[model samples]
Target: MHDPAAPDPNDRDYPALMAPGARDLDALDARLVDCRACPRLVEWREEVGRVRRAAFRDETYWARPVPGFGPADAPLAVIGLAPAAHGGNRTGRLFTGDPTSDFLFAALHAAGLAALPHSRSRDDGQRLYGTRLVSPVHCVPPDNRPSPAERDNCRPWMARELDLLGPALRAAVVLGGFGWQALMPVLTAAGYAVPRPRPVFGHGAHTRIEGPDGPLDLIGCYHPSPRNTSTKRLTPAMATEVFRHAARLAGAGR
Candidate 1:
C-alpha cells in the first residue's frame, strides 16, 4: 500500500541556488505536502476533501498539495495547469480519478510513456517510463482556477521540481495555455533561457528552449478536459500525436 502519511527522507527546503544539477526529487516531493503558501488554495482543497462529491463520498480526500509523479531521471515532463478540484484533490495523484486522466493516460500509454491506460488512484498499479507528470499549481483551486498571485506563490515549488528533474529532462509537453504560461518563468529560472518574446501556445505547437542539461523541446497540446475532449477540440489522435512528439523529442521509442 502506498501510504501518503509515510515520512520521506527527501523533505527539505528549496535551495536558494537555481543552477542545473541532479537533485533529490523525492525530498522535494515530501516537502510539498507541508506547504501552506496560498491560504485560499489550502482552504478550498481541504473543504473539498471534507465535502467530497457524492461519487467519491466514501473515499478519503488528499486535500494537501499534490506532488509530481514519475522517476527523477525521466527525460520528459508533462505539465498541467492545476489539480482538478474533485479529481486530484480526491485521489491524491495528478490526473487520477478523473475523465481528463483517462484521456491523457490513454494517450500516454499509446505513446509508451505509461504502463497503464488508466490512472484511477495512487495505489492502482499505474506507472510511468521516462516521463513525469507535474502541475504548476499543486493545490486544487476553486472552479479549477488559481489566481495569478497564487501561481506566483507556488513558483518556487515548480522551479525546484524542474531543477531537480533538470539533469535528464530533455523535453516537456504542456497542456493548455495556462501551463505554457506558467512554465515559462520556471524554465528560465531553472536555466532553460526561454525566448525573449515567449513562445505562443497552440495545439501542436513546438518550441525549443536552451537548458543547462540540454535543449528541451516544449510541445503544446490542448488540455483533455471535459469541455475540450467532449467538443472534440482535443481528440485522442491529436493528444496521442502530441505525446508522440514529446517521446520523439526525448528520444523515447514509440
Candidate 2:
C-alpha cells in the first residue's frame, strides 16, 4: 500500500485541470468537478449524470460544482439547498431557467435588488445587483432534498464562500427552514451572533450582527419549490418580503 519511490496512483494533479488564467468562477467550477471529499456525494452525482445524460444531452447540465449565483464582490448571499434535476444542474445558473427562479427573480426585481426581471440563462439579460446565491450542496441530488450527512458535508464550501467574499459581504438570506437551520453555525463561526432583538426567521425577519469584516444581516424564507408554493407552505409574497429585507441590508432596497 505504501511506495516511497512511486507517485501515488490516487493522487490527482488538480492544477492541470484548471482553466487557463481562471481566477474565481472558472477555478471554482474546475474544483467542483473533481470534488471527492464526500464519498457518497461523488457516487450519487455520478449516478445522476449517467441516467440524466439522455434526458438533457442538448440542455448542457453543469455535471460539476454549481457555481455561486452572483457577483464575486457581492454584499448579500442567498443560501439554499442543492440543484434541482432540471434547474441549476441543467442551466448552470443558481435558480436560473427554472420555475422557482421566475418567482424568485420577479420578487428580486420588485425589491429593486436585481438588474434583470427574467433569468432564463447564464448570459440572459438578468443579473443580481449586489447579491449571490450559494447552495449548501453543490450537486443535484436525486430528490430535491439532501440527507443530513450531505448537508453537513457541504458546509465547508459555504464557509469558504463567505470567507472569499470577506469584507464585501454584509448579510445572507437563507431560503427555507432547513437552510436557516444549516446556516446558524456558519454565521456563528463568522462572529455573527443573534441580534439584540433576536430576529426571527419568518417572511420579513431581519437580523444584523457584527462580523469580523463588517455587519452581517440575515433574512429567511421557505424555499420556492413548487411543492412549497403549491401546497401554500411558502407563498410568493413571503419570499418577496424576505428578499426585500436582504435588499435593505445590501443598501439597494426601496
Candidate 3:
C-alpha cells in the first residue's frame, strides 16, 4: 500500500539521515541501497533499467545504488569513480559484469587480493581477501560522468562506509583521477590529515595520511576502463603491481 500523504524519503536530506546512526556496515548498506536523493540519477538509472541494452533486454537490472563489497574489517580499500551503467548498475555489485571488472579482478587475483580472476555476477562465488571495493558514486551517471552535485550528494554513503571500516582500513588504491579527487575529501572527513595542497593523482603515486589510529597509505592507479587498457595506457603488470603494493602496505596476505 502506498501512502499519498507520507513524506518521501527521497526528498529527505541524506547526510542528516546518516549522521545519527550508530549502526554496523550491514545497516548502512541497507540504507544506502534505498537512496534516491538525486532526481537526475534516480530517473536515469531507472530509465536505463527499463529500456536496457540489447543483450540484457530480458534480464532484470539492479537499478538502485550499488553498495560496497567485501568483509567489514578489510584492511585494504579499492576506490573507483562509480558503477558502470550496464555493469554494476545492472548486476547489483560494484565492479561486476564489465570489462572494468574483468581487467581489475584479474589483476586483483594476481596480487593475491581476490580469490577469482573474474567477477561476472553477485552470486558467482567470487571473493576478495582482506580487501573491499567501493566507489565515490553509487549510481551510474549518464555517459559515465557524474555531476559535482551528484558526487556531493553521494558522499555521505562513502564517508559512513569508510567510518565503519575505521582503523582496520589501512590502505587504499584509488583508480583514476576522478576517484582520487573524490576520495581526498572523504579521507579528510574521516579524520585523516590530508596535506595542505592535496596530493596529485598519478599512476604509481603514493602518499600517507595520518589518521586517528595510524597512517593510512594511498596509492594511485589508472582506471582499468576499456579505453585505458585497450590503448595500453595501463598494462596488466602495472595494475597488478599497484594492488600488490597496496596489499603490502595494508599487511594483507593471500
Which candidate order results from sorting by lDDT in descending order?
3, 1, 2
Write model 1 residue lDDT over 12-60, tens digit each, in one string. 2222222123258777776677666677887899999999899889999
The root-mean-square deviation over C-alpha atoms between each candidate and the true structure, in angstroms, is 4.7, 5.2, 1.9
Q: Please identify which of the two predictions, 1 or 3, would achieve the higher TM-score against the true structure.
A: 3
TM-score of each: 0.90, 0.80, 0.95
Candidate lDDT values, in order: 0.84, 0.70, 0.89
What TM-score quantifies how close candidate 1 is to the native fold? 0.90
Candidate 2 off by > 4 Å: 1-26, 53-57, 194-200
Indicate which candidate wins on lDDT: 3
Q: What digit string (tens of lDDT, one per residue) describes model 3 on residues 1-254? A: 32456334486476446633838889888778778788898899999999999999999999999999999999999999999989999999999998999999999999999999999999999999999998899999999999998888888888888888888989999999999989988878777899999999999999999999899999999999999999999999999999999999998758
Supply candidate 1's per-residue lDDT for 217.
Answer: 92
TM-score of 2: 0.80
